[model samples]
Target: MVSGTSRAAGNLSAEVTNLVGRRGESAEVRRLLAASRLVTLTGPGGVGKTRLAIDVARRLQSSFHDGAWLTALAQLTEPDLLVPTLMSAIDNGAYESVRVEELTALIGDRQMLLVLDNCEHLLDACAALTAEVLRSCPYIRVLTTSLEPLQIDGESLYRVPPLSVTLSGRTFGAAVAGSDAVKLFMQRARAFNPDFSTTEDEERAIVDLCRRLDGLPLAIELAAAATRAMPVKVLAERARDALTLRSAGSRTAPSRHQTLRATMDYTYQLCSGKAGKLWACMSVFRSGVDIVGLEQVCVGDDLPLEDLWSTLAELVDKSIVNLNGSRYVMLEVIRRYGQERLTELGEEDVVRSKLRSYVEDIVDELHSGWFGPGQQAVLARVLTERASVRDVLSDYLRKSADLRSGLRVAANLWPLWISSGNPAEGRHWLDALLTASTEPTQERAAALWVDARLTLMEGDLTGALRLLDECESVASALGDLVSLARATTCRGGAYLYAGRVEDAMPFLKRGVKLERNLQDDNPHRAVGMGELAFALILRGDLEGAEQVLNEAKAFCARHGEQLLLSWVLVYQGLVALLDERVGDCVALVVDALDRKRAVDDPLGITYAIEILGWASFARGDARRAAALLSANEVRAERPGTHLMRDMPMVEWHASYVGQVRERLGARAFEAAWERGRRLTGADLFDYALAAKVPAVHDAPDLPLTPREREIAELVAVGKTNKEIASTLVIAHRTVDTHVENILTKLDFKSRTQIAALFGARARPET
Candidate 1:
């Protein structure tokens, strides 16, 4: 019932590629034609489904004398509107006058191939409509590409696999003509690299390059572009580090598609100014972007909200971004390139300034407005722009003059982090801002205080101690009660981590006194009270802890700090756990988790999850505990004080359950324990502890040497290792060795971990 390609617009000849593989899919296509009117090619995005579909339709075009027609669905967004779009594409004017059944009947008997490209996004509509068309059409044929099968009736699915990477150099000549990947590569390379003439000797490396790219055509084309300035070998070498790097070699390929950069450049050029600007600024964000975040960051006072939708649409049309449901995202490579362009446009500084202001203003609002009637909507808006918020923090660490803005933002965002169980990322950014900023003020002290609290939230006593140690002098010098109070609370939290339970008491009590004296009665003060209660509970002072929780709750309610109130709820859970009221603990923790999310508190979320896991383990539900702990394990892999030292005790608690199961002779339990152990940081743990413990313990206060620190600082700002080596006048491998040493010294698992630590340690409150 699917429509055939004969209804396809545009020339079929230019679209079709001759059979270049050793075998043909003709038999498969003929079988698909016999079994189902619609055939969907489903696989990973960027696999050669489009080319394969075109070739299939071209071969079968003779059977459908009307001609093979291709109507691409790549740019379409709304699936519900597909029917009208399709009808218009085929220009079925008079057919509209007839019944829908009759209109489909008109084309049912026609023999043609209908090729639909990039139907993954609209898979549901594509499937339903294709099923209907197949039911209506008797002789028509359809071929489509998607990431997965549409699961439609009468649909025969053939997965298009990536090209084999095993082919040798001798196979290049034969392979260029015989392999679709080689042919695609040659087509792109011959146009770029004038010296791209593949000698017999060059054949092996070229094939190796293709293999390394997984033989995917798009990947090959991107790799081929790199050949312009690089030998095939060198191209492969650099590519090992950054797979997205386009070939250095130039070919006769169109400027728009010649290189990955060019393709992205073309996409950028097609966007409206605002869209381009937003897209480029979005590069500052590490993950996907949402509309709320976009509005806050991109649609400032200068850019009106009226222009936002149109700009987004333009970006969608140019394929500069993929609109996911309501949220939109740019690919990592594209985002990086866009960031470069944003800087070049001389608007980077302005954008950064605006972003910092937006964060400060919004966070201030969140602080005051959290418990208001519009709290729900406000929280949703905050959630929507959470990624962008993080991006702003990232920018501030690298460029902002006053660290106060970022520090305030970080302090305000604690609730969000707690709710999301992302203390690691939040704390990492907090640490980075504290280290990266060059300011000398209470703001820096506040940043250090926030950093300490974030680390405490993650249970990273060592990291907390490090930040607290730095803040001690600053708080004392400024006579900043909040900073001093928070620092004391943080120091207590760190002492708690090191199992110095009695030593932690005075600090927590001092923090409580300080919070009481603070004039604003903000959520941060509430947080300090909550931590005091938590410390009390940890020390088995249940009654005192309960008193502290009540105080925190009253403070939060009084200050409209609903988010901080939730952490007090989490503290209540901890109190229940201490009282052996495990079920009550579970309930309280779950409520805290929900409330944390409602207010966008990631640190609270992580704490809640950890408590939940701990309680679940106490309840003898190892399976559920393991499931919950798995998420925490993955989170721990990210750099942060909590992951490195403190909160890992929660993970260690879960690990104990798994270990217990293993000791009882359960293979599954052993496997799970091994996995959990693997998840915990070994060296980062050492580094975090080293930073906190005094030099008397010989813990290596600074994980990286001065040289490593210099390298790490550059890396935090997005410089490549090669760039770092060149800038530092060191050999590339020597730089590599230094990085490895840095990672080892700091107990970091990856560059991201180092970046997180560097971000934290780079700036100290002057």
Candidate 2:
């Protein structure tokens, strides 16, 4: 019997969905496949290059005896290793360094299809390999995907166009329903709102969406994801803010996503020295930036602040920047690339220094508004400049100096973090500040208080207690009542997590008294109260918890603290669940979930989803619960220390064991569970709750014999049936007989899936 690793490539077709507007492209692809050895699909980023290539490759897979091989190049940073990676895929994990001539000699007479996916970044490597393979392998075919053509000899280039949007006679929703763009939209939209199917009334807005996105596939996919909750009209309106969405941007995709950056670079290069300086300086803001910040931060008397508007307009026209009503923003990817180029041109450090000056000026402005009518605007500005704030903090930390500015910024961001349910991230930044301190300083103690509060949410009682103790001594030494109150509240919460209810009560009461005595009206103090309430809830102090939560809610409302309000709601939901008020629990949990999503708190969002999953399971909707758990699993896997905070979710993964086993096959499911358990050990709860997914176990030793597996491998690697027969010294008919048996055994209706199964695996992301 063949082990899984040594078996022939599975024979199956690459799945493709040809939407309404894809009819013309489908025919065009068929025509191109007739005699093309290398049919390269070129288009701009988001212009449907990948989708188009997949669609065509799927249709043509059966013609070639050897199935198609797909190699994705997106995450590959090192180009020199590209050819070797391709060879490994085709040669069944073998890394033999055969010359190009020798490699081609093995497949000289093979009628095979090679599909190179996402080749834009490694275009040069792709071109050279394609040329070598095609020249040497007589019957081998290659299909490549890129943002632009290789422009190599004998290469047939097919430029993929965006979805057609000429549905004037049809209403927008109707138009989209009949188009490939709308199908893709519906697929992603269903993820957000499964009930959201295409409706006639929503057609005009859908068409507008596709049109504004220039019918580009990637842009459409991203925009479609937004439609889960947004109204079609709102989606269309928001599209205007993204300049690349405009149809006039470019018809041709320039070999990947860099086309937009290239445009921005060209525009920046042509700017007046002052305009160029202004552009680089504007990179400081994290969120959508505005003219006022630019003027206040970037403009001087020589490039007077009043004259900034014209430069902004010029930049917008040239697509160097985007305008969103009063707010202007640059695409995150484009902005990063532009920053790199600007640095290479010797303008980065100078621009960054000026950007710092701008950030400081803005923070000063924020300070005035913190007590004024524009507090809302002030908070928005702070959130927008969060990245810049971090930069400032890093600068202060590096100099080993205690700057009131950095401290003040950290304190101010506390309310923002609490509102956004991003206390975890907030605590991380706070800890960074504390770590930078050379001594056991009072300021570090203040930061510890913040960190301690965050630890409570993740049920980390020990860490919270230790940090709270550290905060107490420091705050006492500094004689700061506010800091003392924060430390006191954190200690109380830690006690509550540790089940020391009697000890928790006194500390919480003291914290409340301190806040009232000191006239501390800060929303952070309210967050402390909320934390205390959550602690009370945990200890079964229902009436007291209710009263405290109400007070905290009112306090948050008064301060317009959305993040805090959401947490209060989450606590209320948890209380309702504990009290067996399932309906109330669902309502409150759903509300908090919505709020978390609105604030973009992945950590909070995952937590809410986890609770929702449990709630769904309680409601006997295991399927729905499994789906929620699965989504949370994806979010929890985000790289770096972010994975550490998700330990609770890691424990909950066992709850989905049955569901995972049912969906991924018993063997595969069991393997993953064993791996996870080995990694996490007994601290994680143990349970197997999955239904086993069905597979054809009978094929273990049936149909295709060892000889068939060998022939299938060569056929998949671009060897013709005749070449394979000759290599194995078998009759050509015997090779054909083996191929038929192999296909039957694998249950693959087409060779593309066979090729794809051999190619698809868990590759490490660069």
Candidate 3:
């Protein structure tokens, strides 16, 4: 029944390249289409929205009796020919004489999916035709690929996100290989040179290229094509220039898509004057910018300050700019294109200078906000604009100008580097600024302390000690009490982490006394107190540790310091564990885990998981303990600097493993441990929290229809027929029929038996 004009049975084009990633998005799109008559895939141009829409329609070909029809609207120069073009695409013949009403009647009541591609240029025409078709044919569904929504009644819009290049902390190797962006690049690379292989460096270079391209499929493909003539490193280095090169795309693609610049030019030409000007000016921001920033830098000349928001709205509607919540971002390729336009208009220098000033102001605000109640919000903002800040620092330092500004910005971001698990990137910026500036100012002293903290996180105790010595010397020369306190605290933390507890205590106490004497509500005093307690605990001074922790906890609560509060909870949990109060330890550590998860602190979460695992082992839940340890191991192995290497983790790990092995025996413990390791972090948390394993039965020996199998699997998950119907976007009667057929095929009398059988079969054998 599925028939249309194409090599495939449907009107979908024969895909020359494989669709990579987007498995979740594809399923969600299918579900949306099943429930709504009109579903529009909307994103910026060249984001692969058209290809995704076609792929979704092709998958649902069997569901539509007549077929999925594709009408490409990109080539239509006038709105008058819209209906005629669609009719020809669907009918496989000339429909020059057919009127729009007659064409709507021709599609009447036929169950089908009509795909309207590239509808941004023909919005009015596409919307008019779509309204007519949907009103006349109730059973017909329309799927659209557009830069903007058709905005008709009952339309579902899904914004297509770019391919993921990073997961958790992984960015290269096997992890990078799994990303859809990298997969697309490799596939296209092999297409040109079949014998092509990559070394580790080349693979990393490709990953960097994909990331720089912002995972745009068209850009990735073009970059991949260049690999035929150039090495990956060379291609990555020249990517900004390569976007202007043409004729790399498939001949079958539209002329607009044959080159990156052409694709952008098409979109750019469609934008109105104000929108286009705004886009050009906004390009100066290398990362996302808020409305305030846009107003400050992107207003003047052709783009009046009063027209900013409205023009931005139009640009967003046209998909020329992406507005994510309060911040706006453009795809890297689009930004580059806009930058080129700005240069053409001779405003690049003005825009860039404005951008630099705005960023400098932001960094100053962040520095002032670092120790206040708004610290978390400031940190989040810095994380969002980290790339822009890095670029500005590099430019300032490279030119040997604004050295003090660069030094202050680097120094101010110490808490972020230490807590956000991005110490390596932070260290890179800090090193550049420190090496570029020779003056021993307060800014340099603070930057040196930040550098020492980051170095300590990387397990370089010797290097950290050296950095701290320099920091102390600079702080003494500058007579900066705050920098001196921070330096001394970091020194103590480094010694403690290196297992020199007695040596750590003196520095820790000295830092705490200095901070308290300054009469400041600084969080470093809290940090110093917590570290001193840990050193005391490791030295068997339990009473001293408890008193110090109590003081630290009260300080953290008064200051609204969640990160510091979480560490305090960890120390309390350790004290409870030392006291053999397993239940108390578990309760405290779980609360700590919640705090860490709220702040997205992975290192804190890892440490809490270690403590929870120990408490579980003490409570005789060996399997749960093993699972928690495995989860910690997985988290610790993420691509970043290590943060958990203290005495408690080391002692607890060895003891927990030894005790669990003795209790469960080597073979059974290994099996359980491996099972835990395979579970993702969220899955592991669920496993640890679940009361008991569900019962299961073996798989039935009868073959079943795909629909029946699908229904059976849903039934096994304990969903009723009505729930399954809603989830699958089908009629309740259809689910009942499928379930009936499933039971009949398996000779089961009850859904309970079906659930048990499917559950056992679906779960992997342990």
Question: lDDT value for candidate 2?
Answer: 0.61
lDDT of 2 by residue, 1-766 (tens): 1112322231334454334356688678767767667788764445666666666666666556665566767666666677666776676676545556656765677666777887755767778878888887878778787655666888887777667766533555454556666667777667556787655657667777776666666667556656655677787787754433322233343433334444344445556676665566566554557766676666765478667887776555334466667777764534554555567757665555666666677666664444323555666777777877767767665655544445555655654555454666777667676666635555566667767777665557778788888878877887877778878877876675565767878888888777767653465566567767766776678778888888887876776656557778877876776677756766776677556545555555555656665564455444334544554565556421132353333444565546545655655545443433332211111111110111112123535567865775675566788998899998999888777776676665444323322211221111
Write the residue-wise lDDT of candidate 3 on 1-766 in tens digits.
2344343345776776678888898999998987888999988877899888878987887677777899888888888888888888887888665678878887887778899999999898889889989999888899998888888999999999888887343544668667888889899889989998999888888888888888988888888888888889998888777566555647788998888898989988888888888889988777778988898788877788888888998888877788778889888889899989999989876887777777777777776666657777888887888777777777777667688878887777777777788788889989988998979899899899989988887778988999999999988987899889999989999999888888898999999888787755677888899889989888888889999999999888887778888888988988888889776777787778777766777677778777777776776566666766776777777634263565556666877878877877787688768866886655554443321222222223347877787888899889999999999999999999999887676555567557644653454334
lDDT of 1 at 34: 63
Better candidate number, 1 or 3, judged by lDDT: 3
Ranking by lDDT: 3, 1, 2
Number of the candidate with higher TM-score, 1 or 3? 3
Candidate 3 local lDDT, residue 716 = 80
Worst 10 residues of 2 by lDDT: 685-694
| Residue 715, candidate 3: C-alpha displacement in angstroms | 16
lDDT of each residue in 1-766, candidate 1, tens digit only: 3344344442365742343452455467657766777787754444567777777776666667556677677667777567665665555342222344543765667656677776656767888777777777766677887655677777787766666555444645665455566777777777665556766656666766676665656567677776776787787656543335654534533443445565456555545677777778776655566676677767865468998888776665444566678777765556667788889877777776766776677777765665544565656656767766877777766655556677778877754555555567777777677667746578778778766766676565666777788888888888777678778877876776666768877887787677667666455567567766766776678999999788777766665656667778888987897699886886677666656655555444556666665675565544334534554656555533253355336545546556446533465455444544443333322222222111211223575577876887787677888999899988999989988997777655567546534443333211
TM-score (all chains, Cα) for each model: 0.54, 0.45, 0.68
On lDDT, the leading prediction is 3
